[model samples]
Target: MLRQCTRPIPRWRTVSNVLYARCRTTAPCQPISPVSARTGWVGCLYSTAAASQSQPTTDGHIEILGRLHPTDSATNVSPTIVSKTTRRLHLQRNHPINILKRRIESHFRDYAVMDSMDPVVTVHQNFDSLLFTPDHPGRAATDTYYVNTNTVLRTHTSAHQSDVLKTRKADGYLLTADVYRRDEIDVSHYPVFHQMEGIRTFDKKKIEEEAKVDSETSAIQGAVLSESNPIQPAHTTREAQLVDLHLRHSLEGMVRDLFREEKDLQIRWIEAYFPFTSPSWEMEVFYRGNWLELLGCGVMQQEILDKSGNSDRIGWAFGLGLERIAMVMFDIPDIRLFWSTDDRFISQFSSGQIVKFQPFSKYPACYKDISFWCSETFHDNDFAEVVRDVAGDLAENVELIDQFQHPKTKRTSRCFRINYRSMDRTFTNEEVDRIQDQVRQVTKERLGVELR
Candidate 1:
């Protein structure tokens, strides 16, 4: 007799590797702008509809990250988006975020904390499961960094939600992972950040029975239960209200637990919208005299639940930025402080402890301005990225200070102000000048531009 298979079916273990990436050829380049051959906007690596279908003459040089990544788009890997701190996975151990994450996990004894879910996923997983429309602005190259046409660095931790739900046998999961986005320069914004995704479900038939338990159930007693948020019309008011109550109750408890020490902490619920949920709501806390939005959540869309093989289950999902919460809870001012190698920043907090950060001295900054006439394809994020690469941690701020067009020639000229500062020490004028000079050279060479 043939032996029956003994081992259980493989779960989500193999596909859970976290996403953590260059250029190809340096041939003589030609103009890529549509007006190039006419106006002599030469050597611009611009991509047009036709060019994407067929390679133009000498498009641009491509850089590969060893043999691990292959080129399939305009640019494959960017060092600007990949930082040592990002690749190090700060959420693993000996890190304050990890401490907070573990403590958060302790509160949900039955939920699985997925710390190692892959950060790399297909465009479909990142956008489709989330029900993003095709014209959604988030799909643009300026907003997201792509590995290729089909693959991408996950823009949010929710990318893993569908995969996890479909593969796992558990009723709930919490995902903590690094997410990516190409963004403008500021103290608050970075290309890479951490997010915690929480999702839980209950049997739809059970929810119907629970709706009969009345509004004063122990699960929702201290928690406010108002139908300010919406639900699908497809479901009965009783069913939707029951699911909504449980969602709000659980999330509010988590928020209150995060700031449990402050008995009087101001928290409120605001209705919002998300592609994957109906009548979404955001949780905000009144802190430092301002109401800061903390997390977005809603009852999971029925379509998504069905996709997860949970047509019989009603559930909800919420995602919060770890950096934003940590900054507020710990009183850390600058986002860069989290990556500081200095012990002074890292020593204040021990494992499993939440402490306010002490202020450090601010070093003086040096500013340098570079002006040039660039092709229409020149993006602010691309320029900022190059500045980061050439100047490293020394480049603190990148901003476009000036822009204008010549009336007669119609040539567009723009100036960017790059503030050079060190978190550890101040830079001398000479040292700064040298770095700025290198920045100017590399900016022109890497990005085809005519200096003004």
Candidate 2:
């Protein structure tokens, strides 16, 4: 009984009796929000006025478009709509784009060695800066990968450190960089990978004074053998002091800054080879006595500075592997995981704190140079081997200085530069000279050349 009453229906609509007569008849051309018009059962409204508005053109014509309507007659249509022809895109399964982004972002968040705040980047885009002459075997067609005719993928990041130091003005920074080379695939070597370089400078006067002292020492020692020597300055035994205490500090500091969470980290240095850094060193972080060679670093060559516009500054620099650091820190076995496009590998890195290398006791290094005359038939590479075998643990490095035909005999004369050092004490001249004598005897016996 309470619901017995029914509402009366309105009369059939006529144009004059419709809402048009009671209110506005004009349509809104302007766009409206789809959300706002849908309250209760009210129909979504279109902006008829906005649609009627003219869009001006530079060429004198005006464009007018019809108002858009929502799919539901009562719904309001938004200006922005998902086009009927458009579809959401799905990423390729093996695409590295997103992986790289996540890896870089997450790795930096977790790896203390990464320095993103620093805008400066160092790269070996070109190989000419390295002392690798055009004719050298390292730059040969078979030895290196040519990215182009003028620029080869740099064989090492050492090639760019000089440029970075000379042009960079940023203070307290880090550089994530890389180089390219042609090498047979192996566990130790890769054709392409990232390299981080740490570079800093000290007073030039100190380096100049050191250079003067080195020159004097070389002059006294007869310039490591005059004619048979390969000393570029020809008479100065001081080429560039790269293997020093600061180098160890740089490496350990960098590692610690990158891996601060580690309970203990041990880094060591051993004598190594490179055309650019004199007295070069190969650094290894200890993994239970199985030292892994990270990268080589040393003092910038004088020629490097001259080429880079800083002819007078002296500095030390180093290159390290980002992947290696990640591997050690994460205890990951395969380096290829870094380059892997798998989501699992990338997801592992998303959110983490970065760590740095910790400081450790650096082994003291003793410096010595010895000169000898040897037969020209003995090449530098061949002679270095003989010296290494004879000198055993005492030998640090042997360099070729000058070579020429003997003025008196069928024999050809050559000069050898040798260095002896110990991690414990300063080597006496007598001790170093004795080792030099042994090197001379070995050279004479092996190559049949008279000592000068």
Candidate 3:
């Protein structure tokens, strides 16, 4: 979701884990910017193109998490994403995201919970620490929101994995935080979302000792191990099998617990890949006659553990988006509603509860299409970002309705349809047309594409 504009800084009050920003005077308080309401620090909003061109402060730097950061061409962190830095939706008491977080915490009661990590992190921490290759597409400017050449809005909670593992303070831990990504405009896709990373380490010697007491500890059950997802070369087959079994069993059990109320919930695991984890597998659950991927897990890469001074420990790690599960469990049809301040939305949820979301009346949608010749550097996410920056949450969806390539010039012409609608009220045709015009102007100027 995206938003803009600034209002008077206000005092905050928390009720049932929802932060409300209250104005100091009798003047009506605007909607609380989630992070500002919780942290008592606010930032002025800027459009993506404006933010890219102008620094937030006179010093040619931007204020993020109460610190100044130098900006350059690499600075792509928009004010919309900046505002989400401190939202901490997972920490909100009655929010569905938090409810899911607490439910998982209940299943892993002994795991240490870490939820307050800063969203801004060094590129090394966000990518290199997790073993992402230098040329990986995720590192591209179009996909990531870079604070500068060296920092970024952490794309995943896993960015903190290496640092957290270094402490070696907890045998198991659960880290939850808001994660940012440049994405499409759709009901399920949003630029800012939340994730929870869970890790559990086991001392090989202890596992070996326990295996003698209980043979089942070393057995891999109901899982087919293939060459494609083999144990790492550095790990003993027995230890790897043990850890893999523990990982799958733990996750399957947690899923069952989360969906215990549903009748006959079915889950299956499939082989997967990730730069940081070897022999990875993704868990998916059958829901509404479709398969919904729930999370990804694998035996921790040996190098990661070795780097953390735990060469002797073998472990399993998994990460899941709280929003994905919450949406499915709560029947939330639109992702933007999660960020809404509407009483109708908030009143239906409570801490420790799993209730289906009842959507309020939806306003009509206004459609506008823009056709343009593709530029060499154009990316779909760039177009989406422009629409988000210009239209904010009012832009419900953007779809590529038509595309064609000119045979002689070898140039591509594409058209996108933007669905404009207000969550609270109807939009006049003039208002939507005006917004669409801004989108066209921005697209041409920022993207360097020719209007068709």
Candidate 4:
């Protein structure tokens, strides 16, 4: 049984429906008028080019999510990331990600399901609407995939919160979609992963009326709030408390239901921060002797609600990585496995089932280290992205093992160790050496870092 508490325990337990119309492959390709940033249109454009194995034009533009957008100096989205926009693992039947999505939707039975939204969004929609400040690090090309100066592949599903809330359709909704970020390669991290965003709004009048009759309107009792995580000034203490209670209760119930089959499930809440949410906290579940962070939730920023034309509604929103949860629930050891196409991998599970993943024979790993004089503009993620583009999943992990600053020259040197291994086969030394040679060449040519 899963036990939930506001405070941490020694160890332990714990723990969307929406169908958007997918782009039709059979449809003829046509060029549409260029999208304007000011239109605030949040919809998909289908292109026959998306269905073909076409490459980006020699011109300064690239095709993404079925639309052609001009690329610029800030164009850091690699072909590898662009290719994954169409995978839609969440939409694939009988896949683990899809199965997890279905299980979550079953828990939030009444929330509107919105799985189909364009992966491409305007900068305003992805950042400004979420109240992200101009100087936030996530806005950088190194961290996000920019389609152009004004558009990007969303870094998180929260990008759509304002647009969805503006609809005033469902009081509560669940949105599931693939999100992209430039990140290091590891068993647990990937450039693209699925995320489910959840929001539930309460009518101010209705909640106030309930507070009058209910003695326990404050659902989160004894939880501490600090200067950093203070409730919004616009909300009264009672309002914040009531909404906080509802949010925690709903999430706790969902977690309990998710791990109901496991014994001795333990879960806890810890204070956290996000740009769009105030007084935030993260939920962690004890899985296989580790406390894994499962999701983040908090009261929605009041300004966002105002912008959505729902001034009278107070709400709580949460965004969770489906891959993280699926990894824990299915006992899957590698994140890359979620993208595997092998029959042995895909045939093991069916929709609506939670079966442990069966491990195939393990492959041997090959390691190569490259040392280089560091450039001032060098970013680790950029180096990781380069390796990913060169080696794909065969490059399992890239880690910085040593760093030093030249005492006399005021320069820095760094050494990165890259682990080369294939999920389905062992790598020969000569093949790995060839790949390492290419990595060194590209690292110098692209990053301007001199090889040591």
Best prediction by TM-score: 3
RMSD of 3: 10.4
Which residue pairs collide, candidate 3?
Answer: 17-93
What TM-score would candidate 2 get against the native?
A: 0.43
Q: Stretches of candidate 3 above 4 Å error?
A: 1-58, 209-223
What TM-score would you give candidate 1 relative to the actual structure? 0.80
TM-score of 3: 0.86
Question: Model 1, range 190-236, lDDT digits (tens) per residue?
Answer: 56666677888777778766433345633444223346545676566
Per-residue accuracy of model 2 over 20-104 as CA lDDT, tens digit each: 0011111321101110000000111213223211112224322112222112211111121111001110011222222222343
CA-lDDT, candidates in order: 0.61, 0.37, 0.71, 0.70
Most lDDT-accurate candidate: 3
Which residue pairs clash within candidate 1?
17-118, 18-118, 19-119, 22-63, 22-77, 23-62, 23-63, 23-64, 24-62, 24-63
Candidate 4 achieves a global lDDT of 0.70
- Residue 451 deviation, candidate 2, in Å? 53
Off by over 4 Å in 2: 1-125, 166-173, 186-190, 206-243, 259-262, 351-452
Ranking of candidates on lDDT, top first: 3, 4, 1, 2
True-vs-predicted CA distance for residue 330, candidate 1, Å: 0.9
Off by over 4 Å in 1: 1-67, 74-76, 83-90, 209-230
True-structure Cα RMSD, model 1: 13.3
> Whose lDDT is higher: candidate 1's or candidate 3's?
3
Score every model by TM-score. 0.80, 0.43, 0.86, 0.85
